[model samples]
Target chain A: MIGTEIPVLAVLCGDRRPPDMDAVEAAAEIRYTDEKGLPDALRGADALFVYDFLSTAVPGAWHAADRIRWVHIASAGVDPVMFPELRESDVVLTNSRGVFDDSIAEYVLGVVIAFAKDLPRSLELQRQRRWQHRESERVAGRRALVVGTGPIGRAIARLLRAAGLDVSGMGRRARGEDPDFGTVHASADLVRVAAGFDYVIAVAPLTDETKGMFDAAAFAAMKPSARFVNVGRGELVVTDELVTALRAGEIAGAALDVFDTEPLPVDHPLWTLDNVVISPHMSGDFVGWRNTLVEVFADNFARWRDGRPLRNVVDKQLGYVPSGH
Target chain B: MIGTEIPVLAVLCGDRRPPDMDAVEAAAEIRYTDEKGLPDALRGADALFVYDFLSTAVPGAWHAADRIRWVHIASAGVDPVMFPELRESDVVLTNSRGVFDDSIAEYVLGVVIAFAKDLPRSLELQRQRRWQHRESERVAGRRALVVGTGPIGRAIARLLRAAGLDVSGMGRRARGEDPDFGTVHASADLVRVAAGFDYVIAVAPLTDETKGMFDAAAFAAMKPSARFVNVGRGELVVTDELVTALRAGEIAGAALDVFDTEPLPVDHPLWTLDNVVISPHMSGDFVGWRNTLVEVFADNFARWRDGRPLRNVVDKQLGYVPSGH
Candidate 1:
């Protein structure tokens, strides 16, 4: 049953195990393995299904991808899969794009409202059993600048707009009008755009143009009362500049789901900064996400079975899907 | 001048001082004072405006209400003004009901999303500089039961619906159909209704019928995974029962903005419970709220001067605005 008119998939997952593949099993010959067994399982596979995106096994197992024609990652971010060899190879790369839109939007809303309403102080006071009443900020009529025009960023913009925040968005270039964000701004205008917004959120991808975009100049351009959020890749920001901004009181506060260094070393000063909120790069993961992950893969598998052009294909050199696709 | 033909108003405020009353100063004689000076200030006044709602001066100053024709409190809850003499007096009573609607809705959204997304855990992890990624619960498709059909409660329901919650409301009785809440439920069926909802929020006012409504039986009726929120008065719940329910894990968690005691004792057991979140009764407050309070009172004052009926007239016997105008 080497080829047998069906594609063979090497499914690599984490300790929690891969999702049930019963629905897609009939169309593909799937062999399940943890990160450790990935190299052996990938030997002679026609496709790679990386269910556990955090696994570091893929780059090491690259040489063993004998006949693999395609690789699909069960995450929106392709940072873990951006191996030099894999990027240079002829293999097709696809991602789970729409799966996390709503959940991440909700997460961003949570952080925005938390900062606006001063929930942290409330929780702190609760722990101490102090009944000191304080005024909270209103979410309505506030201004926001979301930096990213991708699905996830747009979703965040939509929810914030619905909640009554005056919302605008920024992309690589100022392009077409978005139903939710209206005319997106060019990333170059960030410094000028930064001054008026009460909230500046970075959800752009990690690329040459976007890396270090949120530098000292950008932070300095923002209002003193403004807040910041990063749900995008960590490299999109200049970490030291952000820390300096907080220390100097250049901005009010920030909630970062991603950082310059992924496990942000224990000794890092960002850990102790009262004005910064640190979340372990988990704004996208939601309950029962694994099931949805498997469902997306299965949908793509059915398309691949009949020789259909795949959805969510990443342009290898560009590192992500092109705009307006 | 002591008993002038022009209407004299008594404005009682707190440490933040009275809101800017330039608009009303030209039309009416405004005498401003804190709790200490209110008794004397209330002398020969045509109207009383309790701008500093927290000051216990209103009750003490009630005996000196010589020429008082109308009283307007700058808050939704009338607990501070619900004194024996004021209740028995024939003077008109009105409150700033609609002013706090949107702000309290946003606060409720903050608490709901904070609990679902585990932002507290994120903050805790940040303190330790640990980048441990964890899955969070989604807000979409979650079921909610919002108690109280007043503007504040309905506003919460509308926003929650936009955020993708299946929301139902309960009023004094279950007769009419609400566009936002669909068919409202009877408060008597709360125990039965509590079983299915993921979130049970209390925004009902303090009243004879609603006092201590959420006791042991109500908590026991809820699903083990459910979360409770109280934006209503503290006396609406049995504090000891809520503490015991949280300890027994009958419900997953709770967030209380109002408690049986204004400054809940530092040694209260609820403070030590990890499953409960406590906030001082400031959910309706926002930045510049003092201005809004003053504006509401000023609007009512203009109406009073024109010999028109006041808005937000409370049904004293029932303790809140009854259904419809």
Candidate 2:
């Protein structure tokens, strides 16, 4: 049964058909529209789902809202969507933090296997009608450092370990013990830890502290055979520094799924590098992803209706502060 | 303590410096040389370790005095090294079966992920400096039909299942209850079973029965989105038929590690297909693989000394008859 005091929701997204529509409908009186039309829809809304504001200019309508008490983002990272007005508002903010963990983790494993097994070279050989036999590295007994102890990082660690890799995780703060991870270290020790591993995976959320985290120094610290993989926010890595690392052989290779600039310009030098694998900020895009989003939204709706704290609530100070309990 | 009897050994290989020289010496009297030198070495040897040989040319070497009692093959497949004379002799033949399982399994998983994530398209987009966000198929819920329930096949099945895939294994005989695999089917039902799976992996040994196993009829029965992967012997698949199927889009794509012709002649058209991935039988080569082989040889040597039946004994009639016990 619909609650008597149904919370009104205004969805501001590029795609209106988010998989979590049923949950949104069950939790509140939801109205879906593009970001351009969001201001009109937010008039009496109690909550809002935002996605469109990341690429395009922020709409003035969101700033004028007084009735909207909560804002939930469909993405794992909310740095692009965060604005001065929204930050200053009393509205509660949340995000889809744990949803893309397994999908992105699987993508990371794919790239690692590709690089280690010389798959790209094999493809090139096949193109030339050449059968070349070459020895490739194995994943077993290799060291991996996962920089981010969130769901995505944990999932990557699990898969890597399953493949017989020795994986270590680094997070914002070192926990005494973690059931899901091994030897959790503080973020401050990431560069030192990076030097010891054959592969470094970045799955941390974007924040002021994480911005430019994988810069010149970080790459310089990695082993000459090490490969870097970023499935998190783009700004966390400095692209220019990464390009230099690939060209100079500071690191063996790199696979990037996110970029500081979307629709990377046609003339960018990164396009020409042989050792880099670039994707269109889409490591988490899997078939039926929309439906998965809908499921998360529905579950959150049930909690909202029951007057219980919603899951995946973002900390106002840090954004996506994973639950401690 | 050393054994009272110093057993004579014949090592027939292309390279004299076998990686397991120390282990070989510790086990028995070692006579190391290439295939051309095998005849002279065979006169005094009690056991033989053959890496490569000409089956038609080396018939007499297997029948020298019946003193050469045990034959150990360094490769997973004994086809190239196995002679008809040796098969008919009273010699015990054992192979390095489990040595390459993990390495080959890693390669299979790599190709599977590469196809599902549309990695080829991503690589092209990167080259064109385009940011195209497309939804990729996930391996999580996909069904895989592994044709060959050997160690390599089982290893591949385990890795695929760990990534959330539903894997079915097929073998020579259908077991009513096998706890290790899901839905074990007989090889005769391959064409019917091929229609429903997203991935078909062939790791069966080369035999008269398996020759031309994945032909035009098999490809025609497969789903349009299905992919074929062969890590087994090359003769098991018809190369021309595979080329035709790929060109006609009868199957989505294929990754081949072995070819009917080694060094896959420079002019073969199979190399030109963008959908196909080809490698020159290096999936089993990994760092420290030689050491693993040595360990296997050492364990087998101890068993042979104790008069225990060997682990990977190949059945002369059936060839690689799995221990029903």
Candidate 3:
């Protein structure tokens, strides 16, 4: 038997219809609010789901509220929201970790194919009305190193292997398991392993150890023909080092889906590079992405109401450490 | 112990290189002829390998030689050179099959991902400096039907399955078993099975039965959201019907690697449509492709000289059917 007395739930964001809300509640409605409306919404709320990126923009009175028992962020990564107040609070924090796995994985594969098959060249030729038939490289039988073992990383690895690539993954702590994937390597071994791979993908979380991880030294260690893809936090890679690597031909190319600054400036040198493929951090934004977020929140809500451990619970000490550590 | 006397072989095309010529001459040295220099080169030839696209245009004297006991085509499909004179002779005919499998398979996957993720739209937005994020469909759990069971078709099927799609292949004759693939359907069942698939790929060879196989009726039977891909032969699909299908929204989109006429006439209406992605029949072309062809030819040469059955031998009755079927 389920409880009929629903706790007050506050949603922080614009009124984009949350996915699976009908299945989540018949009469258990959630109170929606913007940043200005947050204090009122959180007055008596027991749980909060933050969908607005502005929630962490300013320290709000809601953070001091003692009634809030759990906070759910409708994003795969919570690095931006990890403040000392939220980190030190007794409130449990959960993220939409699994939501973006497949979509982002698809994006990685799409970019890889685009580069390998010379789609950009084809597009350029099409504009000129030229019928050029050129041989392109094959994705098959190439070795790849995925430098993160989270859901998104694993998904990319799976898709790459399916395309006949030799895919290995790296984690914070290598367990030597993962039978479906190649040998799991430790982060310390990345530089040594990177040279043998044709592709190196960075999907690691933004941590003290991972920040600026792909620096000049790392790029210098990769093969000249290898490609680098970074879908993780932007700060995880050193932009200047990446530019140097590309300019010096240390790596063949690089694809960035995130940047140190949001809405990358038009004058940025990244847009000028022929080899770099820049995306506006939209890899995880798919047709039903909002619905997926709602579903995740609903599932977590049910777990919280039943006094069960919340799913995708963020490690406060590690500051957004993924589960299955 | 082997014979000390090397057999003299004539190559119809003069573009033979190391790996390819080496492959052909593993058992015997091959003397090649330019189309303009054919008579001199074919004088004392014991075997001939035809690599020219204009083989049918060759002078009558080259085909009349009784000393030429074997003939091999460098291309996969041998319909262009299948004259009644060549078919009736004791001359052995072989083809370069399985050489282009990985490249074509990579191309198919590339185009499929491009369509699924709206890469064209993304690129357009990138050019316009717009950061519009939209939902995209995932390739996982979707169904794909490859309408040909040849090496190219099977390779496409393998690659798609690896990307986590449910793939079914239809061949000219259903052998009922393919260890590398699943659910090999006969050609007659294609129309009935068309509706259930999310992707339809035409990879069948060009034949009397397969010519114009993808007509209005086939398009009508397909789901409105399904995407069609053709990499087999241009003649296998009715291009007019495809244009109509895209216009009427009978299908979501289509990517064509081959067309009824190549360099697909600039005035063709298909180019005007936003949903169509056209490639110049170059899906199988990739770096090192020429070398792969040479290896295939060389391997078959050893069997030919040892008085053993050659690989990829065409069955004249079935029009380029692989022998031993």
- The DockQ of each candidate is 0.77, 0.67, 0.56
The superposed Cα distance between candidate 3 and the true structure at residue A7, in angstroms, equals 2.6
Worst 10 residues of 2 chain B by lDDT: B53-62
Cα lDDT tens digits, model 3, A1-325, are 1366777877788655365677556545577877777777877888778876534642465553558878888887787667778778788888888889988898899889888888866765665556788888988888888988888898889888878788988887776658545688888877877798888999988877788989998999999988999888888898988988998999999888888776777777777677787778878777778877888888888788877778899897776645584
TM-score of 1: 0.94
Output the lDDT of residue B285, model 2. 88
- CA-lDDT, candidates in order: 0.85, 0.80, 0.78
Best prediction by DockQ: 1
Q: Relative to the unseen true structure, what is the C-alpha lDDT of residue A52 in candidate 2, on a scale of 0 to 100? A: 52
Cα interface RMSD of each candidate: 1.2, 1.4, 1.6
Candidate 2 regions off by >4 Å? A1-9, A14-46, A59-62, A298-309, B1-10, B20-47, B53-67, B294-311
Summarize candidate 2's per-residue lDDT along B225-281 as a digit string, tens digits.
Answer: 999999998888988999999999999999889878877888888777889888998
- Model 3: per-residue Cα lDDT at residue B15: 61
Better of 2 and 3 by lDDT: 2
Alpha carbon lDDT at B187, candidate 3: 82
Clashes of 3: 4
Compared with the true structure, what per-residue lDDT tens digits does model 1 show for residues B1-325? 1333578888887455665788788778888888888888899898888887766678877888898978888888887787878888888889988888999999888888888988887876776677888999999899999998899999999999888889999988896578879878999998987898999999998877889999999999999989999998888899999988999999989988888877788988988888777888888889888888888888888788877777889877777767574
Q: Which ten contiguous residues of candidate 3 chain B have the minimum total lDDT? A: B53-62
Go through the candidates in order and give the clash count of each. Answer: 0, 4, 4
In model 1, pairs of residues that clash are none
